[model samples]
Target: MFVVPKPLRLLAALLIVGTTSANEPIKLYMPDAPPLTLHHYVGGHGMVGDVVLTALARIGKLTHIVAEPWPRAQIRVAKGKDMLIIPLSRTPERENIYTWIAPIMELERAFFSLDEPVTSFAQARQRYRRVGVGMGTAQVGILQREGFSNEQIVQLKLGENPAHLLSLGRIDAWFTGIPEALYIWEASAYREQNLRQSPSLASTGLYLACSRDCDAQLVEQLRNAINQLEHEGVSLLLRQAYLPLQPDP
Candidate 1:
């Protein structure tokens, strides 16, 4: 029988006893949606992003949060890269593609206009030819579903202020989440434009979506922490931080 060297035997024992485990920090990615995730905001981190960080602290795992364009973030998560993308709208087509955590918020999808009220989508189309939408947003699909054609849609950069386009008359209307519209409108040069939100076209849930490579146990732990926040009413209080920004309806 061949005898193994003593140091090699000790190394083997160490490998067996001290192998790298699943407790390392995970990388997280977020898009540039304010009041949620961004490079800069009223808070150094974003609103929901801060909440997520606090929740992760509860679980005591190091997590790195990254900010990139929304499309790139989606692609990273979709390709099964190990990352968590936040405020993703859960859709039927995306249901089975990723792991989901607690919903961060619900976005009311509706139209914001610069001119007279557009009570209906058809009326809006007749009154305004160019409508602005955020690039690669769920609102893109929602608008398409509402029968707005390519010619009528102007795809704007993610996190860009569409109120500018409407104020400049480059685009007559904008379709976006109520919070985002309100946030941008509050700061736009045309804050006095009196941009009105049409009746909610729809409301959708924005959640934390994890890549397939993200460990199931870690995901469960994060989900549990989020659930605890919700149960203890901390989540709602965090959300209420932005409630003061909503325009009177």
Candidate 2:
């Protein structure tokens, strides 16, 4: 082996021992999108999905991507795997449960009714016949908080499939994020083709919550990277791209 200068040798040793601030590819979990997280037809992507992947790129991390249903993704993060869930709202229960780094995106929850108008959570709680909601979602918690019992709300695995039930008048209203409710409605091949989008009833911010058991250093690195990206204007660029496409009610 060739002899190396002392300074160069020291530099090489530091490079090997020092923690890099660069991004490392980590597994990410996202559920299918209809409204809240929609995949693009052109390249099989959605807004939240794009944000997760692109944010990793911004921080120079290798991105390992995965797509699964919401429940499964939740399970993965709960188990303390090397993963992150995106576009999730911040709630008290969640804070107690998971280690997350977000408010990644903002979302509004609302009702999509079949016959009568249900604007407020108060109205939905009192006048609704039957409501549909995604199981294990923040929307479900909201409806539960409004005093609707388990019997009144139909919990489905995915929010997109609820519109068919809504169209048949089997359910009175669908409780979901505005984007998802609209996605389901527009994708339906049934009645009420002229159904209109409703204004948001409640506004909540989404986040990239990770498991509490993950490496603290990794978590801080990501948080710092995301904050840096925000300061550097990457986050704003993304918002401008996706915000214009949101439904206007």
- Give lDDT per model, in order: 0.70, 0.63
Clash pairs, candidate 1, are: none
The C-alpha stretches of model 2 lying farther than 4 A from their native spots are: 1-25, 38-44, 190-192, 197-199, 236-249
Query: Which candidate number would show the highest TM-score if scored against the true structure?
Result: 1
lDDT tens digits, residue span 1-249, model 1? 111111212222222211222465666777767655545554434556655655665666566666677788788887866677787889876788788877877878778876555777788767778889888788877778778889898889865668777887888888888777787688678887677778787788888889866777878887988887777766676666554365545
Shift of residue 204 alpha carbon in model 2, Å: 2.1
Over 1-249, each residue of candidate 2 has an lDDT whose tens digit, in order, gives: 111111212222232222323445576666666433543343323556544545554454555556677877787787866577776778776776678775566787777775555667787778786888887788877877778888888888753468788777788787778766665665568534555445677777788777767778767766776676566665555444434334434
lDDT of 2 at 148: 87
